[model samples]
Target: MLFIFGISPKTVKTDQGQFVCPICKTRSAYEIKTQRNYFSLFFIKLFPVSKPRESAVVCLNCGTHMPKMVLDH
Candidate 1:
């Protein structure tokens, strides 16, 4: 019998919009992402291995990820 299983991290985009990035210092397109660890079988994701992490706002222009608090400021 052959068995292969592992845990893998996956990042998914949950939302998209425009925001003023603190690092980029300009309004740009952004993607809201959530990262989660998933159990994989033979390179196929089966189930989540851990809780979903806090969402991060990623800037498409400068490729920087910032906390949601940046939107409040």
Candidate 2:
């Protein structure tokens, strides 16, 4: 059960394939991935970390960005 509910910020999705800059509509963009590793402490039991998920986001044009909240299991 605990293994299902993970972290924040899911993946990157674009409406036009290329993310449009909020300020200007342009194809120019860049990607950045964030990786993290940590141990989870619980009162019932001690669990081992299986794998670290790669959370990412991209800035389309104007450098404006939003974080993805949920993901499919």
Candidate 3:
């Protein structure tokens, strides 16, 4: 039997997201530029999907690092 856990695969539409940088420990935030698919190829290597579902948020300041997911409904 396949073990079922966590939220199922789905596409959530939104216009914004938020995250706090660990180093700065400040409310550093950004805006979602587009919607993309989340992928997990072999539990060991999980990351946002590439191609077709290609979209990302861009930091207004430093243009580096991965984007933060909006966890709260």
Candidate 4:
């Protein structure tokens, strides 16, 4: 019997809005994404492991990831 089990991270886009990028200083489309770790079996995701949800805001123009504090304002 052979079993392949591992953990993988999957990112999902939760929201989309416009925001001013601090680095680029341009109003551009931004995407809010969340990443979660999943338990994989034979390269297929079976369930999620015990891990905190990771969130980030990305700018479409300059591809910069803005900090949470900056995005709040």
Among all candidates shown, the one with the greatest TM-score: 1
Which ranges in model 2 have alpha carbons more than 4 Å from their true place? 1-19, 22-24, 38-50, 67-73
**Residue-by-residue lDDT tens digits, candidate 2, 31-61:** 4445444343442223334453555445645
Clashing pairs in 1: none
The numbered model that scores best in lDDT is 1
lDDT per residue for candidate 3 within 4-61, as digits (tens), equals 3332233444455555544444455655554444554333324445432444554434
Q: Write the per-residue lDDT of candidate 1 for residues 1-73, one digit (tens) a residue.
A: 7989999999999999988888968889999999999999999999998998999999999999889888787
TM-score of each: 0.91, 0.29, 0.31, 0.84
Candidate 4 stretches greater than 4 Å from native: none
Root-mean-square deviation of every model: 1.0, 10.7, 11.3, 1.5
User: What TM-score would candidate 2 get against the native?
Assistant: 0.29
Off by over 4 Å in 1: none
**lDDT (Cα, 0-100) at 65 in candidate 2:** 46
Report the Cα lDDT for residue 5, model 2.
Answer: 40
| Cα RMSD, model 4 | 1.5
Q: What is candidate 4's TM-score against the reference?
A: 0.84
Considering summed lDDT, which 10 consecutive residues are worst modelled in model 2?
A: 64-73
Q: What's the lDDT for all of these models?
A: 0.92, 0.42, 0.45, 0.83
